[model samples]
Target: MRSIPSHHRLILAVLAGACLALASPAIGQEAEDGLEIGDAPAIMPVDPSDAGEIERGARPSSSTGDANRLDRGERDSAPPVTKGDKPMVGGEPDALQGINIYLRMGTPLPDVPPEKPYEGEPDTAYGAFQRGLFLTAVDRALPRAQLGDPAAQTLLAEIMSRGLGVKRDLKGAAFWYGQAAQGGDPAAMFKYALLLMEGKEVPQDREKADDYMRRAADAGNASAQFNWAQILVAGTPGVRGLTAAMPYYEKAAEQGIADAQYALAQVYSALKDVPAEKKARAREWMTRAARAGFDTAQLDMGLWLVNGYNGPRDYEAGYRWLSIAAARGNVVAQNRLAHLYINALGTAPDPIEAAKWYVLSRRAGLKDPGLEDFYLGLTEEQQKQAIDRANRFRRT
Candidate 1:
């Protein structure tokens, strides 16, 4: 393992501390609202397993602690990572990254109670608002919102825009979101900005969204930082693009915001606009995000390893990571793995094995047109034989 530099350690520690501070309050508030902070997975350590179910890459990387490993349903009283060499997040690197180089498989989600607002001592306005969600409580929620209940205002906006508990009222939602944003709710600001951009509850005021996103990002909202970063990088449909958001992402990334770091790396890696020096810097940023446990970093790292981009070529290592990601049900990884197998990029040619993994990838919901159809063409007997063979290999 490479030694962590003292400067980097200090920076990482400071950033981690800030993230915990912010997440701590949110967790506490949620717990107070009837959800247990201890019940949710920590800010970091969102499971990659969901990647399969969601038809996307797995969840991003997390922080250093391994205190609790609560899944959506099941809870293990015991701690998840007890040993050294755990991934920067709570899972084993192999499990989270889908690389077989080191560590055991990650913990899977267990059956647990779904999150709900606390019932006892219910905030009545909130209660009525939630109960009437997009149906009947907009008026009640609006009054409470006017009285400075930020939460109520946010709820009213959500219901109006989504037509959930209230009538479909985009203007109403925008109004409420603006109110909530002015009340200093970062989430409200981000949502409001998004709605403004989409013209869902407001005019297609992209400039307004950019403004709100900037405010939310400045206030340390990770998702907002990421969205803002995307705009800054693309400079498409927005006045200020990557140039404006780069610093914001840096600030958020240093605060343990994985998405910001990932976005920073991506923007830096854009060969068309980025100079060689910037590309190098981007690789460094990518490494930082990867160390922090970003899933896209894992994929990017794997690609880099295979293509010798900003690093040495190592097909075996790349394949290991890709396989790990594929096992976790990342459709992209699965598709990539199929490509690797078909071309024998890093591993020995094994069409049967490739076919089996492809089938599993499809089951996991990958949406590659050619690969999907190709996998669909296999004879049932061939598929059965391939699966059985793959299973036997896995066991061995």
Candidate 2:
């Protein structure tokens, strides 16, 4: 499977963190206490050509510097924040609100299926295509595409979109993708939808884009599944999209989409009115996300396990996860881990060890006056030891 791009991963982290802030009243309190909540992650627009290649399974090139060409208004508009709104602390935003999250996060486009050997004998055209002979492949496939071969049209679209052997022609690529989509190719449908949504060389038609997105998702494209779910949760007309988005999130999460796993965990955890059994499921999803390397989920899981929320307390496990997140430079995790160390929740209380983490957390711009006082109260030798530990930790 292809990896998510780094910028896309950052966006997912910011979105998850935002949703988490919405769900945790502690975040509001932290803000009021003069702690830095951190700036919202910046959105870096992706290249439109990269979007086409991603949707068609081609390797993305170093950006051609076209990221800024995308219209910011089409991509960065968030849902309106109304007057008197306190940002819905301590509960999951409803599906409609989730749409705002999706908008803010920005879509990372789609992924095409991995290349496979053609059925039975390897077709010469695809064989060349797979072997990196883009010009040869295009030469061979052009006739077939002209003869109405959906696969050939799709291949040509991929080549044109990425400028593999020819000059980039987004309009040409969109035309071929539309043809393949009309021929019932799910990948083509997805690519076409992206073009439609962006209005790049094609008229922007969100209604048609939505229809095509649903079609591609229903056809079992994992990327389509996740994107369509976001659209549903964001709401349409009078419909509450949450009831519809759940299954899609599940499908995408099970398919190993880390962002989907994180989103699912947030949805489950935010359902304040759900039964205990349902909440347990939420914890399970959160653990899945934590294991998937979502730092926010790791922090949350550690807190949940430490406090016995939604399940029995497992201080050792909590300490393990919190330590993992702290090592990755999460200040909140560092602070919490220090608390656990000082309190002897999972291990023996060691003021020196607690002081080490407290110092590190504070350096990361998290204010903890109480922890500061405690650290200052230690003996000179203990303070020296803690500072030594902190220096060693920072070196790593």
Best of the candidates, TM-score: 2
Badly placed stretches (over 4 Å) of model 1 are 1-145, 149-175, 183-185, 236-241, 255-258, 271-297, 328-332, 339-349, 357-384, 387-396
* Per-residue accuracy of model 1 over 263-286 as CA lDDT, tens digit each: 566555532455677667766676
- Go through the candidates in order and give each one's C-alpha lDDT: 0.56, 0.67
- Those runs of model 2 whose alpha carbons end farther than 4 Å from true positions after fitting are 1-142, 146-148, 156-183, 192-205, 236-239, 272-279, 348-353, 378-396
Could you tell me which residue pairs clash in candidate 2?
none
Winning model by lDDT:
2
Local lDDT at 391 for model 2: 84
TM for candidate 2 is: 0.60
**Alpha-carbon deviation at 11 in model 2, angstroms:** 8.2
Candidate 2 per-residue lDDT, tens place, 1-396, comes to 123442113234333434454455223213211112122211112234433232223333642433322123422455555532335434645334333443456654345578976568556677778867676677777788778888888898888888876677777787788878778788877777766765646777767777877888799877777777766655431123444676777787888776677667766665455456655687778788789886667887888888886678899999988888888767788889889988898888989999999988888788898898899899999999988988888421
Q: Native-vs-model 1 lDDT?
A: 0.56
